[model samples]
Target chain A: MQPLPKELLIEASGGDIGAFEKIYRATSDYVYTIALKVTGNRADAEEVAQDVFLKVFRKLGKFRFESSFTTWLYRITVNNAINASRKSTRRRSGQVEFNDNIEVADGRDRTREAIEKEQNEARVRSMLETLNPDQRACIVLREIEGMRYEEIAEVLQVNLNTVRSRLRRARETLCSRAQQERSIQ
Target chain B: MKCTEARELLASDFLDGELDKDARGEVVKHLDACDGCRRFEEAVRRAAVDPLRNAPRETAPPSLWLKVRLGIEHEQERGVRAALYRVWRSFHVPWTAYAAASATAAVIIAIAVLREPLTVPGSTRASLTDTEGLHEYIEEQFSILAYQDTNGTGNGANGNGADSVNFGTLLEEYLM
Candidate 1:
């Protein structure tokens, strides 16, 4: 995703409430999606999104515009999501609350397609839970966010080789788990 | 490339298109020759893509924006409170330390003042006697001075009075 223009960021940094609101509206979904994938739970994802934006708001002035705001936001979101995921794991004993009430409106009066979509999403969320937080983050960023390995390295603050190895191991684990599920099916 | 090497490359760098042309060619050739490697590659591809494509792009709930706004407000509130708290603490800590030190010094001074007389080695009654003896010695010295003055001057009024009052009688009278 493209970063917001410098002028808007400057305005927001200058404490313009409207400018910050626009920034939030522009980026909250992206942040939420990442948080959801990494955390694999809606509630935790929401909390993570809340934390990321709050950090952004608090630290907006410190942003030097040296890097794209999206990259900076990604770093914040991923780190907070990882921490939130760990806390949620410990708190819930690995029990993800798959609350079905937060369904996306498909405009089909909740038809089969909507049900299938919900099921697919639930399955994907469960699959994401199989990997550790780091691996899940790597895979989510690489596959879902379509970030390059180098970019993932930058956001994850790891070396390129580490990103490669993490992606490889994460894929291996995920593939093996998929195969197991397939065979079971 | 051997199947092992190609599988490693295929899983990550190859899938990511990060492998160089030559490495890519070798992995491709291996995949072409080895059905197992091809299936593994396919499985990895599926594993990477299927779930991601199916996983919905969740919109931030409507309440999320409200929550974030409230969070920012709360953060601002906290920022103000924290600034005020720091200011309070900055002044409070030193004053508290000074007050504590002053109290300690006062206690020490009081302890020293109150303890000095009690800490003396002699008994209280003996010290009273010593005070009485000092008073008696001072009275005797005064009496001798008065007697010398009267006798040396040959003043009968004073001489007679001094002669009439002996040291013992004078001391007894003073005591009485």
Candidate 2:
């Protein structure tokens, strides 16, 4: 989607819903992706996505043009997403801990080589499940999503160094578990 | 720093190349000497890569984001419409009381402006000081009342008083 114009957004802040709708369409994906990545569940992502829009709608009138509209919206979404993830953490930790009987699916491969690769991948995901949501999210964003450290920091509304540090710590934790699994294997 | 602080740094700082040249050397030396830290490094590398590489690359369910965006705008539209409706509702009034007060005021002012002392039409009006004018009209009427009166002698110079021309007897004699 094309980036929404800041000028159109300024017009929208004066109560132009039609203009704001255009801005919403342009930027909703940007917000939703951050939610999906940060919160790590479709439902939480949806809730966070809805919340971002509602906040944007309510606060649109108050948005003075002191900062870039995109950056402002980015900050709001990041802040909302981070808060949602934190709340989900307490609930999520319970589910993972209490539901250890979560039916582990059979590894999806038959060939000897494919089975090994699938097994390794499965073990990786299992290990990742141990991370707190924020750290898990940082790992995903940095390694798989390939976002720059600065961009991740922006999406999480954290300092770039925080993003790097979290990534490193998360990686170390996962590596520790993987090594233990290797020892057992 | 103790091994503990160094471990914390090794976890994050080593990744960033943030360690001073000497600190970096020490961490490398420690990693060469320590089995625990090298495994930590290896685990961190795997944890960082696996999910990104394998956890499903998801775009949101199509048009869901579109719907949420439209929905917020719709909500905003309704809010403005509600405010406008409230302002419009405020303009309606109970007309009877206001109308009645206005009508009564108009009637009282009209009466005050129109009321005046009565005047006779088509008359050169006599001033209030002309009381003598009414008395003079009565004096002019004195000649009009002068009329012949029959004396009790009844103008009876006719030989006998009885034969005198009494008003009634004279009429009788004429008739005879």
Candidate 3:
């Protein structure tokens, strides 16, 4: 993600809507992406994104320019996504919410590449769903976002060892799941 | 390093490129020596890390911005309404009426207290708070007494003659 101008942040913190819009436009893709990846659902991602921006707007005034804005944003986004994911998880009683079989609109072109991409997406979602929320968060941050372990620790407000262990355990689960799927195939 | 330790490193720091030079060297050496650890590393990459790393980036829908904007505007309106409500509530307490009533009551009490001296018919109590006035008042009371004693009657020139007769009989009457 590109870094936002400090001036824009200042203006937005002072209640400038135009500056805030720019900030949103610049950061919303990654924010939404992070939310979607963590929650494994578009609807939940949308909700989390909306919540994150609102919270940012409300608390922007108190934001001391100490840390990178994206880091702060990642923290809020991940926390909200994790909570939403957990709620949906509980709502469905352990059933994963990422439905690979949902009907796509017929008007869209159904190319072979598109189908493969969709399948790959579904596979990734299934693999992610095997982990608990914390492990999933670590995987998404470390794997998807390519955030360093230290940055993940900062974002998740956990220690480096904790990030390491979560990633280790998460990948272990994924490797095992991959092996199991291969054997079944 | 054992297979377990090397595989753990592969799962975490090795794959993530967080390992230091010395530790990474040890893990690489272990992977080179052990087939199981090398396969585990490849599996970890194929299964977990690579899929996510290569997953296509998605943009937020255009509608998301609209929703966020509407939410922000709604929240601002709600905040303004809440602030206005606080101000309205403050004024709604009838503080003006309360303060007016309080001031009126205080004035009435003050007037009633102050007017008592005027109603006493030559009452010296207000002035008696002054030392000179108190001395003059006591002297006048004594003169009135002396007159009544000489006249051998309760009637004195000051027309407090009745008061003079009863004045010294009780300490309360004397002070009055």
Candidate 4:
């Protein structure tokens, strides 16, 4: 995400819809992507994104400019996604399966490339489902969003060593799952 | 470095490029010596890291922003209603206080009036009768006064040769 201007944030905090819309346009891609990756399903992702933006809209006034806006937004997005995923976990099965026939935002592509992209995304989502919400969050932030360990620790509000351990555990689980799937195939 | 320790670092700092120069060298030495640790690192990367890093970035649906805008508008409307209710409650509370204060004042005044000494004419209140021997004492004093008046030694109406007043009638007139 690009660095948002302090003036823009201040304006949005003062209830300027146009300014807030700009902020949304700028950040919604990563926000939606992170939500999708963490929750492992489109419906939950969409719900999480909506909730995240609403919270940002309401609580923008309290956001001190001392930290980066992306960090703050990422924290909110991850927390909401994890909570949504956990709740959906209790309501039905353990893991919410990613919908394979997910509609792409870019309708321009009906080619094999688009299909490949969708399949790849589905594979990633399936792998993420094998971990618990906490480990899944660590994987999404570290692997997908490309956040540093320190940044992830700050966003997840855990110590640095905790982040390291979670990422290690999550990757190890993914490795075993992959091996199991390959053997079965 | 042990294979177990090398594998931990490979899963985290080594793969993330966060390992220090010396630590990275040590892990590299261990991986070079251990085929199992090298295979484990490859497996972790293949399974977890590469696919996610290569996954396409998803955009927010066009409807999401519209939904959020509508949600915010609804929230603002709810907030306005809440503010109006608070205002109404503020006005309502003072009237309740006034009513309570008026009822309390009325009760206190009623109690004070009931507790005052009775001075009504011909009134025979139970409280007066309940006093210890007060009725007998009053009757005796009236009898003495009547006797004195009859002998023309008291300033009473019966002193002018009027028949001595009946005690009960005098007592009633005194009350009046």
Q: Identify the candidate with maximal TM-score.
A: 3
Show model 1 residue runs off by greater than 4 Å: A90-109, B81-176
Better candidate number, 2 or 4, judged by DockQ:
4
lDDT of each: 0.81, 0.65, 0.85, 0.84
- Model 2 reproduced share of reference interface contacts: 0.42
On lDDT, the stronger of 3 and 4 is 3
DockQ per candidate, 2 decimals:
0.46, 0.20, 0.58, 0.58
- Report the Cα lDDT for candidate 4: 0.84
Question: For model 2, how does the per-residue alpha-carbon lDDT over B1-176 read when each residue is reduced to its tens digit?
Answer: 45666677766657645567998888888888778767766655454554455654445566675666677768867988999999988986778978998999999998987674343354344532455654555554443332212222333333443435344466754762
- The TM-score, computed over Cα atoms with residue i paired to residue i, of candidate 2 is 0.53
Error of 3 at B157 (Å): 66
Select the stronger candidate by DockQ from 1 and 3: 3
lDDT of 3 by residue, B1-176 (tens): 88877877888999999999999999988878888878778888898888899998888999999999999999999999999999999878577889999999999999999865432248655564567767777898899767776664543234444434543345645564
Report the poorest 10 consecutive residues by lDDT, candidate 1 chain A: A92-101
At residue B50, candidate 2 shows an lDDT of 41
Candidate 4's error at B93, in angstroms? 5.9
Give the per-residue lDDT digits (tens) of candidate 3, residues A1-185.
77789999999999999999999999999999889878877878899999999999999999998999999999999999989988897553333432543435431668878878887877787788899989988888887788899999999999999999999999888889989999999
User: TM-score: which is higher, 1 or 2?
Assistant: 1
Q: Where does model 3 exceed 4 Å of error?
A: A90-99, A104-109, B90-176
lDDT (0-100) at residue A135 of candidate 1?
A: 92
Query: In candidate 2, which residue ranges exceed 4 Å CA deviation?
Result: A1-30, A65-71, A82-129, A133-169, A176-185, B1-6, B16-36, B53-57, B89-176
Considering the two chains of model 2, state its CAPRI-style docking category.
Answer: incorrect
